[model samples]
Target: MRAYTALINPISGGGRAAERWEPIARLLREAGAAVTVCPTRSREHAVALASSAARRGEIVVAVGGDGLVRDAACGVVAGNGTLGIVPAGRGNDLARTLGLPDGDRELARLLLDATARAIDVLEVGGVVVPGNVYAGIDSMATAVINRNRWLPGALLYRLAPIRAVLTWRPATYTITADGRTRELRGQTVVVANSGSYGHGLRIVPTARLDDGMLDVLVVREGRLHRIASFLRAAKTGAHLDLPEVEVSTAREVALAADRPIPLCADGDEIGTLPATIRVLPASLRVLAPTAPRQSR
Candidate 1:
């Protein structure tokens, strides 16, 4: 029997993680796996718990959203353990990227098999981000989502951008990718490892977790009236066709702005501008399907 430790964020998905994990835990136990449940009090606590369990040669399962998954990955990397994920958060972006199953029975079966796949991760200012790191208006929208936790997940993610755009100001952004620099006046810049975020938006359609490169997207400053259309286009990755959008791939990226602009990764605010992000190739071993479903 495999030893597994589940680090669950009690309040994730509007306090639905624990409720969602119950059936999965029961299934694992029925499969004869030794499953240990740990309810995380905070992000720091989740990391610590994951590290300790991983050091014991146990599979560390993150049972929450992308934020919790990032924390668990940090600890698992430190302890050199394999990772498992259960999608019980508002934005299961990483789970979506890995093509993890939504149903409890399917997820439990996948967990029991313990199939591991190596994937790339983003290292930004000493933090591990499994999805994408973004700045400008998207970061502001993340701030708005964080403040209004009472709203439903999809509703909050959809409305936050509109709320953020009301006060957003364009910034002169300097982006250096693999030492090649470019300057642009933009409202959003995204360095993506996973193609999808904001519940299911295909922010960068060409990004892949094992690609060993970062997909850098710059949304050039445009008329405020175009924001809604751009967002709608982003859902199907059609925004890349817009003249204001630019996409490229690089191994490392440095971002700086004329003024302070907040940066957000894996659904949490990391820091401000002048940040350096690099891809750690094949750094994470995750229990995922043999073939990951790509975002359109």
Candidate 2:
């Protein structure tokens, strides 16, 4: 029988993955799974390990945050294997979208017993993003969040974007979505697969994982206070109703800007933009909850 391989990031969850591994392993084994725990040395290493394990017909479980999950997804996509998640990472936003249980024991049980469902992922500039693709001020906030993994919980989530807003500036962004091209001076252009990011902020409130289409959000440049107000509105997904924000849906989106703008995928900086993102419908097979919590 093909065993389950757990690809764990040691630094994930502020280094909590190492502390949580033993019990997670024990639980899986007790549940009659042939578990092979793989501690990843680096992001690239995790992808390599997951890809290898999946090639052997084993289910690959990502035991960390969105970054590790993104890496594991790449491996699973490449090898055509099923993916599972044990949300030990800080944000666990994707886990939240999947309606994953808060408790680790329940999470482990779900991983071991759950059946696979196909989900859509974004193909952004050669990267496989299982969640959302964002740029501008939002990406800046994500950069801050990525740098301060030690902050933990509320402080990290609340403060990072606050800091990002202080240094925010708009750029001339040219965007083409579903063949509709437009240009604007904006703060962000987001293509969401799962919607929420930066610790549950609904950047694109209506985005769904299985929608077979991507939700694109645009926030044009505004006064500092207005921008701050927009950020606050985003928490309750009220930003979508703001006049400064525009929302659209498409199967593909291409973005470019006059200056080099930072880009992020699944809450980690992938690279700067001038890229095309397309939806791959029902391409990823993973263990997902039947009912996902709606972010609004």
Candidate 3:
């Protein structure tokens, strides 16, 4: 049957996503979708599969976590297809943003049933690089983060303070946004496309996908415990309310680093700095969740 299919990441969400294939397929079939299933074997494979699926004008639902969704996003954003999600991952960041249910089969039905909305995308560029992915942080941070990367999803936030303390102090960097420029010495600076990082952390909680603006947050020098305290406040939308956290809005932000810093995107590591970011408004069509999404 020629119908919309799901691209599943076998390693996502502890491989529980693969376990859900049968039920999700049945649900999609019941919803009048043909339900062709595609499994991603690697990063390049995901890109190839997603691009191929989008080329044929097929709606590809992400059946795994954010990494898989990001991979699928690379494909759909360039083509006529709209992307949907089933939140089965260590961090279902995008899924929560879309207000989809936790169950794979249920989310499939919900996405198939809802109205599609066009959302923005951030294309990050560095030196000769130009691509569609939000470089969340510098690459130096990615190295330090990867050294202790074996920790589970939620604990990574806890490790941030430790990384801040041990991985050397924050470097002074200059950032220019929309003809205005400033400098900051911080441990973490995030360029957010959509709100929510994962595991209930609101790095840029007030962000909106349709607003045509990118939100930037910088966590400046602070005690490790204080940094943890700040993350807690972010959970309830209070982190940016504090003096330690600085919030700014701009169409583009350029960062200058003495050395390449660590970087991350969607939920995985991309190459390091320097990074140039610009928001493309309403760049993608998405299946909005039926119910109201909880405030991110």
In model 2, the Cα lDDT at residue 122 comes to 90
- Put down candidate 1 lDDT per residue, 1-296, tens digits, no spaces: 78899999988988989899999999999989999999998878988998899899999999999999999998998788899999899989889878788899999999888579999999998888888999999999999999999999989888999999999999999999999998989989999999688989999989999878899998898865677777798898899988888889999999999999999998999899899999999898999997645543
Clashing pairs in 1: none
lDDT by residue for model 3 (85-141), tens: 776776677767766676765666665676778777777742111112333233333
Clash tally, candidates in order: 0, 0, 9
lDDT of each: 0.90, 0.84, 0.67
- For 1-296, candidate 2 gives per-residue lDDT tens digits of 33789888888887888676678678778878799888998768888888898899999989889989999998888889999988888888898888888776887777777878899999986678899999998889888887876786668777776788888778999999888998999888899999888777777888889879999898888754665576688889888787778888899999999998888898688889898999998888988777554543
Model 2 sits at a Cα RMSD from the real structure of 2.1
Per-candidate TM-scores read 0.97, 0.94, 0.86
lDDT score for residue 68 of model 1: 96
Measured with C-alpha atoms, the lDDT of residue 181 in candidate 3 is: 81
- What 10-residue stretch in candidate 1 is worst by lDDT? 287-296
